[model samples]
Target: MTITVGEIKYTNAFPFFYYVDRNKLLEKDCHFLIQTPATLNREMKAGRIQVGPISSFAYAENVDEFVLMPNLSVSANGPVGSIFLYTKRPLEELEGSRIALTTTSATSVHLLKILLKQYVEVNVTYDEMDPSFDEMMQDHDGCLLIGDEAIVTSWREEVETYRYDLGELWKEYTGTSMTFAVFAVRKDAIARQRAILEELYTAFVLSKEKNRKEQYASMIRHIQKGMGGTTAFWNHYFSNLVYDFHTQQQKGLLLFYEKAYEEGFLPKPIESIKIWGDVRTHHSSLM
Candidate 1:
């Protein structure tokens, strides 16, 4: 059966997904949908895409309909250079200031809220606006941005602002990796395409291993060409990102869910992550 898969259109996902085309078997069975995490989340929920990396918050919103893929995610231990809050005032000093959040985000928006309210203990108003740094900074004290836009903004020399990497901040607050997005599959689709899913997992792992073995200088050059970052910047960004959803990443995501739940961002508290994998191991993990 042909399975629909959502591919996150960001530099962080390249190591996990870039080499999928090398697997001829998967290329035939998988139909890929490339889009931003927010768009992918909506598509996955609508059943337009059977499996893909989606916003962690979106997974919680439709927890019953989906199960997470094993050993696959978009996460970082510290200083994920792609997500930043460029602020006018110092972070602690912005108690009553206004911040603009990117409307294109799902997980980062809630992550920022959890940090600002539960950790920072700030009483601030947030505006949901388009991801335009110049426009956002004009009217608000800070702007929470993610993906390529955040990276480009950080690289730009002209617009100087105090920038805080959300991943680093999350690590400081929780002492664990921040899992921004996860591979989520429709429960029904999992039952129908179990073999394909397993192969897909193998291919993804192989892709990640290959990426880690070398600098992939050509890929870096391509990224620099399109994104306008220095070769060193792109190299460091890719080298440090964590893509596997092991124990640490899982713990971080669970804590995030807990915080999101307490803040009333989710309808219910998620106790354990439901996963798509070996039945015995999945049950054991839940326990």
Candidate 2:
């Protein structure tokens, strides 16, 4: 049987899929496809892709259909280079402000809304805007950008922008490590191809180690070719973007889901979201 794996074209997700594609790590029948986060979520929801990295919100939104793998996630504590809230006014001062959102990033957008409602206690308007930072900054009170677009820009000087780092905000509010994205496999897929999934997980662990030691050169090369940015920019991103497969971060994720539930962002409270394998015994190669 063939497994269609959906992966996001982001630096954090690169190490997970890159090694498999480059080395042909899977069985001959198994295949993978690289896609944007939105596309990945769509395909996964439709049961088209058997396994992949996906938005945290997608997993939360469809918790019944998938199970998390041990020791793999896209997360950072202070500043996740790819996800940011750019605004002319401070988050606290943005009362009745119109915030522009990138339609592609459901996780960040929902996160921003939850934060604003909880902390700011302000009623704000949300509108879909162009993904371009400059364009969104022109009309909206603030804009949320993700992926390569957020990485390349100088938000500090370019515009009168108040940066709200979502990851940092989450840490402050929850007192737990934040998990932005996770490696999840469909229930049916895991049941049918347990061995293949285990092998894929092992490959990810190996690649994570090699990626850390080598400063993610191969992943960087792939991103740089598509995203026009300086080495310094990419360096800052790589340095800050952490790849850790730890069960410890589960606390933060649970808290996020709790808050989302309280705020009515999720339809119901998820009692528990467990990692598939034994996290205690799984040794990650991430250095």
Candidate 3:
């Protein structure tokens, strides 16, 4: 049977999937379906897609049913291009203001709450608003945005904003690389199709290297269009956005889950969840 995969449309997340599709690396029986991050999580939770990359929070939210694959993710140590908090007031002032949240990003919403509670020392009201940053900025003191929207809006001059980089904050608090997203498979899929999944993961790793050199220009072009930035901006952002999946990064993932649980953001302990794939199977020099 063909395996449907859900993924985000942005360049940072698409290169690996694009490599697989462009090379036709999967088995004849397997096929992939690409969708937005939100749609991907919805489909995975509903069991429509067997495997795909998704937000770290989504994986935590549905931890029991999925297995994390090795060697592929969208993450960074200090600055992740996709997730941001834009505010007219400094983050410290958010203590008493109403904040508009971009409902599209589960990870960012939780990150904002976690950071605010830790730093701002007061609870703030959260209301969902249209994903448009302008509209959100008008009615609320600040806005949370992710994916291409954050990238495009970060360069705006009129928004008198103080940017809160969540990835950086995560690193400061945890002292490890933050995992913004990960490639994961359903638990049943891992049990039934372990061999194919392994091959797919290997292919994905090789493809990432290949694309880094052979398709960098195309990737930059895509980012420029999707993110509304110049080639230089895309180049800088892509270079800074680390994609390596390693044990060191896993420490951050585990830490995020651990803290989220302790802070009551997660419903249960992370140890109870089954992460798909064996980390020992893959080794990376980058970590």
Better of 1 and 3 by TM-score: 1
Q: Which residue ranges in model 2 land beyond 4 Å of their true spot? A: 22-27, 155-157, 228-232, 278-287
TM-score of each: 0.91, 0.88, 0.87
RMSD of each: 4.5, 3.3, 3.9
Which window of 10 residues has the lowest lDDT sum in candidate 1? 278-287
After the best TM-score superposition of candidate 3, give how far the Cα of residue 53 lies from its true spot, in angstroms. Answer: 0.4
The parts of candidate 1 lying over 4 Å away from their true place are 22-29, 279-287
Model 3 per-residue lDDT tens digits across residues 72-177: 7888987787788888787766777888998677667877787788645667889987689989988888888888788778777876788888888777776788
Best by lDDT: 1
As for candidate 2, its clashing pairs are: 71-245
lDDT of 2 by residue, 1-287 (tens): 78777778766577766655533544346677787677788899899998878888889988999998877888877677778888888777899899889867767878888878986688899998758888887788888888766766653364656777787777676566677788888988877887667767777777777788888777777777887666777777777766775656777778778888898889988778856854222442322
lDDT of 1 by residue, 1-287 (tens): 77788888888887777666634654566678888898999999998898778998899999999988788888999988899998988889989999999987899999998898988888899999999999999989999999988987877789878999999999999898889989887888867877666666666766776777777566677677777777788888887788889999999999999999999999999999988767222111100
Ranking by TM-score: 1, 2, 3
Candidate 3 lDDT at 86 equals 84
